[model samples]
Target: MKQINIFSIIAAFIGLPVLFSSCEDVLDKKPLDLIAEDDVWMDASLAQANIYGMYENLNYFSHWNGDPITYRSGGEGYYGWDYYNSYNSDCQADLYWGHWLSGRGKDDTGWTPSTDFGWDAFSLIRKTNIAINHLTSEESRNSIGVSVANDMLGQVYLLKAAFYFMQARKYGGWVIVDEVLDDIGAVAGSDESAAQKLKLPRATLQETYDYTIDLCEKAANLLNTDAPSGQINKGSAYALLSEIALHGAAYLSYYDGINVDAYYQKVIKSVEELDALKKYSLVSGAEEYKNMFSDYAYAQTCPENILVSQMNESYGYRDAPYSHINRLLVNFGTALLNNNINQSFQSLDKGYSMTNAGAQIQPDPQMVEKAYYVIDLDRKARRFEESQLFAENIDIVMEEDRWVPGAMREKRKLKPTSSYTSISDLMYSRRDQRLAGTFVYDGSEFLGNTIYFRTGGNIHRDSYVDKAREMGSMTGILYSKRVPQYREIVGNLNCTNPIFRLGRCYLNVAEAYLSLSTPNEAKAKEYINKTRVQHGGLPALTTETGGELKMIYLDERVAELNMENDRYLTLLRTALSWGVTDPTTGYPTGEKGGIIPELNRGNNPTKKLEIEVPGDYMVEEDFMKPNAYFYREIQVPQSDHNFIFTPKKRYLLPVPQSELIENENLWQNKNWE
Candidate 1:
């Protein structure tokens, strides 16, 4: 028998330790002991044990860490195989292997398929299919009570839908396996010709997508409405449905398909149905919103999270440790910083005391550019003049208050050694809350500790030199979101990962409305405003055209969902809807514009400052220049960031080479060769 089915069957029958426990509520805990395979489907609780295995394959998003320079060997062994952070397609992270964009990798050879994206999801599918098959059978249902059987089937169906959706989005066309193969004997036997005959070929992309939708619909009907946190329910199915509908609608609209509007209607209906459940609502207020990402306990209670994967310490699946998350983004202890001009000396000892503190990956310059969209520039300039320096010239103005540390930073006067102005106060204390919550800028206070992301100098005494290849910088900017809260229980990094929230649903509706033949300005704005007004205190959208509004919607997604691993997908989908030509290369992929440039590292222009204090006394500048302190900051290049999309080929990942040989009838994606 194939290992995929064999393992799943063994797990299903033996009963793994996966149990039904909520992020807060403790349900009846299953024992760690294994049950006999024959007796597994005999009872409701035992059958439920197999269902828990389905979620084990779920991806947690932001674990995409690796050797930024080498590109080989990194990440939490399982999650983020997409190389999301460093692939540098849409994310702020640096890229390691740039050639993959050109449709070449170890598996792209004509003889075999590629394993670049690790697209071996067949095992997970087979496992999911087997569980579903058994749970829906007459004998299993009779043994497991009617209600329990329905609920178990629903959960399995939901898992199946998600797996198929993932396959469809990545591979476009995929082999559909809705049932467990009892002919595993033939498949594993010496009759190679017979096995080849039985091997399923790829289905059309449309069929794959429709089948996923049907699976989700069935799951929604069968799932329990009152399932606890971490368990899939009716609401989760709707959330999945809405996402699937929006994706389908956008893709269909891109190709001018006839049923695009119908799919859009489904998107709206599904989201509204989810909302009608009343099981979740967006968390209000700035502090409350921050808690959704920072504090695990608060996250568990947040009403907005519809499909959340739970992490726990005692027994449940714990996510990557908090320290790992910190190290990947902040480089907390290693302090890899840009050696800016006239920079002050930094001592590694001064930063976090942890051993892994300095392997920091600073945000790409493009990220800072996106952050600007959240604020109203005109309003800030007119009403909050002090914020202008920080808002526009963040690289030059956001300096560390060297003399004032910790909580004292909020009250201290700008020291002579610091470039610290009133900008931090204007930005954090009064501006949009999302800015403070999402990023760690200069003059920001995190857990009462002062965060210093200064440019124009070497801030770390013992800096990691290799970070230069990774494009490390001292632009007084760092990336921080969903990090452990300062007051949270220590070692509780098992935060609930949000799969669907009301805020995203609103975005979906807004986009779908805008995509219609006659865009609904008011309806679209209404949905967009719900997120803006509730989360950021930003004004509601009222007078923007459809194109302008689309930009705003994209900006909001970057602000809110960047770290959650949606950037590349968002860019891809948007590009598909309206094709673009590469400005630099003049390479047009399709009739419509859909091209995206791969931007590169750039440096900000030098700024001359007049300080009352002597050059020797300035901590912002350690080395004194002959005439004036010429502070040069690192910036994201306005043009090609070292990459360009090759339209169709880049959008869909190539099928794995092994999969091709295993199923000779399968066709490789177009242009992959």
Candidate 2:
């Protein structure tokens, strides 16, 4: 799901205030002047430009804003709320953090500040409609226009279906806006109809789901992946239809608190279609994977890549952890690479190493814990739980005034001038191999010289690079993936963003298969082994995922989609009674009791946390110890009121509150207070 983030809007709105004009009307202008949809959609390429804009806006959302790792990575993102004292990893913390009152009335949480990603989704729907309305003008639709309009319109619906589905999942109760809002005009004061029109109430989850699915089917008939990338083709449309059904079913199943057979059927049907599509196949090769993400993939696209985001050096504003440098800063110079301490950020505050590590998102243990249970028969050779998720083992102890992993190699290898770190090279050690692919670990050969972190290099954290003297065994992990790949080192015309690849299809099929209950171990094994064979690893690695095939879903997903913005969705897939507790209400309208309320259910030990930060650093919501209200709270009560949206609703996002107010037919999500 491509989405826009606050960063873009920030850039958009930044230059507005600087201008000082009286009545020039210069500022009151459209981004593209004179060329409105009236003339644009009439042409094929211009219509495509609009689509490109939509794509640009959505990429950020997919990569960062809506990205799971952005929240759960290293407990830096929202996923690791427990890492932050004020909030915990529990879903309740999210609701509390996004409190109704706090989120209401123009505030960012509700609508005022509006999420860029959220807007991108709705805007995409609106933009697509504009394309349709233009194409279906009385003139066009009247003269053999039905076919053309239907084709384009089908694509729009497919895109919109995707839009609404995302909304339903995020906001639960969403407002349905079938068309664009040309203008808000003026807000009518509190009259009965005015009040109703001004504040769109949430639509029933059922309505949102029904509408999205309907649109998907309508689009499915028109789209074919073989169609040019610019248009929604058959492959894109059908795959999306399948995606909506599968995701919709999952969302409904969890939120409705009913394991409806209908939802399962939806998934099965879509899976069937996905199986029928013949345009995709997974790509293999470290270089191939790397190049697959570049523009170079077009000619050599893996059979797996069905839909890919249009990427280039510029012509669009957007941006990954495929960082080789930041990984260095994190590992603090372990393995063969020395720490990449930005001397500029170096401040000798006594002995504390304090530099606001650029927005590091960490994963919450609770969610990571669940991934272990999503059994997959494909990749894992060992049975495990979240307990198996090997996070960088940070051991900040008072002993020896250091956090050292008592291993002789670790202790002897510790950089003499260093500060804190894990006994095991958490950031760069043996873990998801994706780490190696996405990061530049110390000692790993790169360039003509050793690129790993070193003790006394400019990359070190020393206040002054020249003064930095010691050089011990380097063990830092720096990621430079999304970093601008300069043209001097890499040519641009050959780069492409690895948008929609085939790996996900395998997972989608596996998940659907698991949901079927009678998962064929042999079939599951076949899929898992096939994926591994691509990586040149044993085909039956996931034998340990589960004695049966149900356990391998999450593991296989992790192996394939790690840090690819799927982690959060993976958790949301298990969309638990996910909400905040109101001391006043037993469990709100729809939510489950959580945190201190017997959070884990059984022998499952309650979650605990111990974050390591610089001595003077205070715990923030995304970087705190476990036990904050959410971590310490109890499970949400399981009841009707506890649920907000239906499973179908999970697939779509609620329409923005402001938009609903302007549209008479639109309404808000029912979950609204």
Candidate 3:
């Protein structure tokens, strides 16, 4: 084997992660026929190449940590997965995996092997195991294969563990496997004892935790510690260890019923090493801040990211959510313009029923208002005012920040970072920098020939509104945050979707140090202050600032890593009970059912059908008490019914049933039924 060099990092960063570009994207309906392990891994270079493919597999969006809720964006409606005809579903609580039926549903568990998602989950594990055992086979034992084999095995182990973690989070516990147990052999057993023995039961959470930790450690030992990041670097080992240990702590203490500070300590200690690596920091100020998220961030992971998934910018190649199509797909929802003299509604429901109708996942007034406060009030001048629905959020710091309407996301098109500069200081004042990177207020130089749902392709919003006098009256409020002034040629930009970033590491270090301060006050202060200094954040130990390690870090984290980062995952993993909830508008629980009346269908000019607001919706508060279930942040739809609907259990996804049926030795986790 050759001596490792800086080029090793370069190769891992650029070349290797792209190895399985077309082959590994999990969303591909067309699957790739994998190469047999015997044909590869015999030589060092080939083994190295295969390792890249495995890493690429990890980059798929389906491979990352996921959120439970999908937002309705404009706050006008709610529906996704379950009962969301927009997606697909049986509308049944018994089925856990479907587009409309959310990971939110709870019912009979332990899915059968034949279900669709279960099949997908099964394939992932099977693929991971095939890679795992092949690396351990005899052909891989020669001088070249040993280290390569170990690295491969450790990675597959980590991925397997990570996969199960997703399942455990969703299904409570899940079926797990280590060796590449063959399906045909398990099924071929003729004797009653053999057949009976092949059937598996559920494994305990403790057993899974121990298995994950061991795999991480073994992978750490095999992969050279100083190796570059893209290909399972030592940092990856530490990351998995930290995640598994923290998860273990949560499971044992909260679920399996045992307190394990030792596990917490392990996570903290592991993360400390990553912190010392000096490759990351949280960007300070609004300009460098917004710039950190745009196309400028291409080929770069912020200093704090442990692992990152890079997008292909290829059509249908990247994760479905990160694609250019979703971001700039023409307004195939409703028509915005018509030649009629009045601002008539050009009803163009694009080729679908309520299920297939077009919906711009715009940010609700609530999210925009909070973002205004956090960005405008906390940072600069006011830009946009709070809409009437959310006007009370102005001074209320404790209001639950709404989950981001995922679709109103910025294109990061060819706009300057300072595009968020405040003109109307009253509107844009006191907010986080992330707001500017994300939204396009009135001052932005927006290009449009944007396609309206009523019209087909090659049309612009400007042309429609200006030429079509009837539709000119409709303004920003119509699309709301969905149609932010887009700047780039929506089709050509090579923007890569960031799946993981290093910036959160600073946040991680900050959180750990802050939490530690309660007991080891001095030591905690040291670590906490160090992170702030490293990031050029507000200084700690200041007289006016209270100088308390915990509070300082908490404030700094929200300021530096706001919306782009998953505040929810960080909060949940840490077992921190924090997140705001507001009752400004009362939710539509079943008690209020039938009172709001069903949505009406008509295009009557005199007989109007406007939206109705709940009568108890307008009380305001200064701060909201965090709810128990929403430990950090759990996203919810904007609809009234969703506000009343509680989320749990179905919150996490299950291990697809395929692998369970195939691997005889692996047992199913408990209570999925």
Clashes of each: 28, 132, 51
Which candidate should be chosen as best, given TM-score against the real structure? 1
TM-scores for all candidates: the values are: 0.73, 0.58, 0.58
Predictions ranked by lDDT, top down?
1, 2, 3
Winner by lDDT: 1
Stretches of candidate 3 off by over 4 Å are: 1-36, 45-51, 60-120, 137-147, 184-198, 225-230, 284-292, 296-298, 301-305, 316-325, 328-359, 368-424, 444-487, 491-493, 509-648, 651-673
For candidate 3, the per-residue lDDT at 353 reads 16
Native RMSD of candidate 1 (Å):
9.4
**Window of ten residues with lowest summed lDDT in model 1:** 20-29
For model 1, how does the per-residue alpha-carbon lDDT over 645-666 read when each residue is reduced to its tens digit?
Answer: 4455455667766777777878
Q: Candidate 2's C-alpha lDDT? A: 0.39
Residue-level lDDT tens digits of model 2 in 1-673: 2211223333443443221111122123233344653555565545544444444422322232232211111244332421121111122221111112111111112222122224223344545566666665776555435666666666677767776766665655465665444334122233444334333445666667878888887777765445543334655655555555556566566556555446545655664565577556666644444444432434234565555544333322112211111211222222223234323322222221212122122222343323222222333333222223221122222323132355221112223233324322332333333333444443343322233232223232221322221221111233333332322222122233344455665566555554443445555566566565564233454343332343344445654554444544544453342232232321222343222221212223223112223232222321221111112211222220121322222323444556554565654444331
Q: What shift in Å separates residue 104 of candidate 2 from its native position after superposition? A: 18
Backbone steric clashes in candidate 3, count: 51
lDDT-superior candidate, 1 or 3: 1
